[model samples]
Target chain A: MRITIIGSGNVATHLAAAFKNGGHRIVQVYSREIQNAALLAYHVKAEAIDRLQDIDPETDLFVIAVKDDAIFSLGLSLAPYKKLTVHTSGATALTVLSSIMPNSGVLYPLQTLSKNKEVDFLNVPLCIEGPDEQTTRILEQLAQTISNKVYRINSAQRKVLHLAAVFACNFPNYLYEVARRLLDKQNIDFELIRPLILETAQKVQENLPVEVQTGPAVRNDENTMKMHLQMLQDEPGLQMIYELLSQGIIKNTKDGH
Target chain B: MRITIIGSGNVATHLAAAFKNGGHRIVQVYSREIQNAALLAYHVKAEAIDRLQDIDPETDLFVIAVKDDAIFSLGLSLAPYKKLTVHTSGATALTVLSSIMPNSGVLYPLQTLSKNKEVDFLNVPLCIEGPDEQTTRILEQLAQTISNKVYRINSAQRKVLHLAAVFACNFPNYLYEVARRLLDKQNIDFELIRPLILETAQKVQENLPVEVQTGPAVRNDENTMKMHLQMLQDEPGLQMIYELLSQGIIKNTKDGH
Candidate 1:
């Protein structure tokens, strides 16, 4: 299968390499930044197209891996090609490409990607959606070649999944940063909490997080909670977050699960 | 080293086993619940004592692994023996035990403990603080036998570490639970986001979490944020949380990593 990748960012670079390694031909690479396009294209042995008009019309799939706002304009720009174009976005709708092309889909890889870090595509779950049955089947097969887990999720379900991913992934890291900051405030090394963090994650994988919950909030230890609040008196913003999250945990736990 | 455990709950059970495994003698086990004391004593090969007067003063260390409220009272009760005593609490001050015994300290394990789970104490950071140098040294040696990561954290620092663990471990699980609840509302399987959660955690461990931050929040994608808000219309409490967290992330990222 021949593929043309739009956008030369982390997601685009990683996906392009994964596809190339999976025995698919990368026909072209596009980026608003010419240097980024050239850099990724050099690796995949593809033409670096700075403009959308320079895209190869002959490729089997055109993956628009650009920013969310750029998806519509890029889809419209690639309308003439009329191939099975897809956008690798978790939140974008499949209909965004409907007016631009009759055959389009989504190939959202549900994993955090970085250009330098090599991604094990087989471990990444691909949430995909297509306009028709044939295209959906093709996308499923394509995703299966690169990933072990493939789900036929539509735009609505994908949006919810993306929202959940934010909570499960992004927000947790933010909390981690907050934890690190708190530790740093006391001239203490944050590395002390790494094992605890890793074990917390490992426990959730084996069982539901709610069942395995511990700490002051779960136990409703008011004395410790008060002590923590007193410690966070300086950082009112962090104090608010601490209180909100504690309350959230208490509310959830009280909701009978 | 002769040790007597003053609690029979999760922390006490795990610490007793770890001490026994580290080749120390558990001389006695005390608990408000007679059966709990008997059960833990049998495993640790220690005498079960319900009365404080029954405590053997010959023991080198009386490890108080009881609840926060019980610490003060229990310390007072054990004052008759006046053996080297330490309360395993993150929030409680070292002075709480000092009032009861001449040689008292803290043996707080900076990790979440549950009755069902067995933890590898070798890496769990033990935060030790004592009134005297000799007592501190002895406690440090005892902590080192079980854990590689031992720290001389004060009562204030221990409280901070405990608070940080809540953010890194407890609150993150609650956030995951929120996501799970959202999935349940839409009849979507919560399992779909597991890979994303796992990868997010892995990425943060490999790099600074701030470097790997991604999502509508970090990107400051207002349109997506609005859509998310609309989707969560029925859940006012969750909507508020989402707004605050999203705004917080945006603010944190804007300040530059």
Candidate 2:
């Protein structure tokens, strides 16, 4: 299959490589910055284009692997190549490109992609949604060439999953930064807690988060919690976060009971 | 060493087994309920004692593994057996047992221990703090028997590590629960997001979280965030959390610049 990728971000770089390596032709790569497009195009052996008017008309699929905000605007400009066009966004729905392209679909990879880090695309979960079953099947076939885990998720569920991903991925990483900062103030190496972080994630692999929950919050140890609050009295934002999350954990336990 | 362990909870259970496996004599296991003590004692080849009066005086090391609130009261009761005493708590300070026993110290295993799961104690970081040099050395030797990664951390530093740990382990696990609940509402299986959770944790093992942070907040994508906020309007608590954390991510980026 011939493909024209319409972004130069992390998702675009990875998906383009995966598709190219999976025996597909990368006809062209487009970006607002010509140098960025040229850099990605050089690696994928595709022509680089900064303007949408110069996109290949004969490409089999147009993958708009750009930001959620840019998808609609880019779709409006690529009206000529609307056939089987797909956007790789977890939040945006197929309706965003509905009027521009009836054959539009979604192919959201449920993984954190970094362009510098080579991700094993085979293990990444590819979530595909389309206006029709035929479009879904074609996107699934394209996804399967690079990944083993593929699922048909609708727009609503995909948006919810994206929200959950923020909690599971983005929020936790921020909390880790919070932890790192806390350790830094006390001259403690963040390395000491690395094993604990790894083990916490590993525990949830076979068990539910509720079953594996452990801490001062779960134990209802008011003394240590008070001490911790006193320790963070100066930093009100952290204090609020600490208080809110503790309350959430306590409330969840009560709800379970 | 003849070790008498108090409290039959998760920490006590794992520590008892580790000590027994590490060639220490299990003198006794104590709990408010005799059955709980006996259950753990049965596994470690130790006698079970419910009352504080029945504690063996000949034990070389006394380990108090009870809840934070109970530790001080339990220490008062165990005044007769205060020789080389240690409490396995993260947020607790050495002064809690200072007047009750001058030979008191701490042996906090910085990992989420569960009674059912077998942890590789060799890798678990044992944070020890003693009242004096000789006491610290003795506690360090005992800690070395069960784990390779043992650090002689002071009370202030240990408490900081404890606080950091709450952010790293406890808060992250709770965030995972939040994600699970979000997925549950949509009838989406939590298993789908497992890989993302694992990969997110894995990325932090080798890289600083600030370097690897990703999401709508980090990207500052207002469209998707606004959509998420509207979707979460019904749950005010989650909405507040989303706002606070997003602001935190954005603030961190600005601070970085």
| lDDT of residue B18 for candidate 1 | 90
Q: For all candidates listed, what's the TM-score of chain B alone?
A: 0.92, 0.96
Minimum summed lDDT over a 10-residue window in model 2 chain A is located at A76-85
DockQ of each: 0.71, 0.82
Residues A1-257 of candidate 1 have per-residue lDDT tens digits of: 99999999878988999899889999999998899999999999999989866777888888999889899998888877777889999889999987668999999988878775566788888999999899999999999888898999989988998888878888898888888888888888878887777777766776777877888887788888888888889878777778888898887678868
Clashing pairs counted in every model: 0, 0
lDDT of 2 at A220: 84
Best by DockQ: 2
Highest-scoring model, lDDT:
2
Instruction: Give fnat of each prediction, in order.
Output: 0.71, 0.79
Highest-scoring model, TM-score: 2
Give candidate 1 misplaced runs (Cα > 4 Å). B42-49, B53-58
iRMSD (Å) of candidate 2?
Answer: 0.8
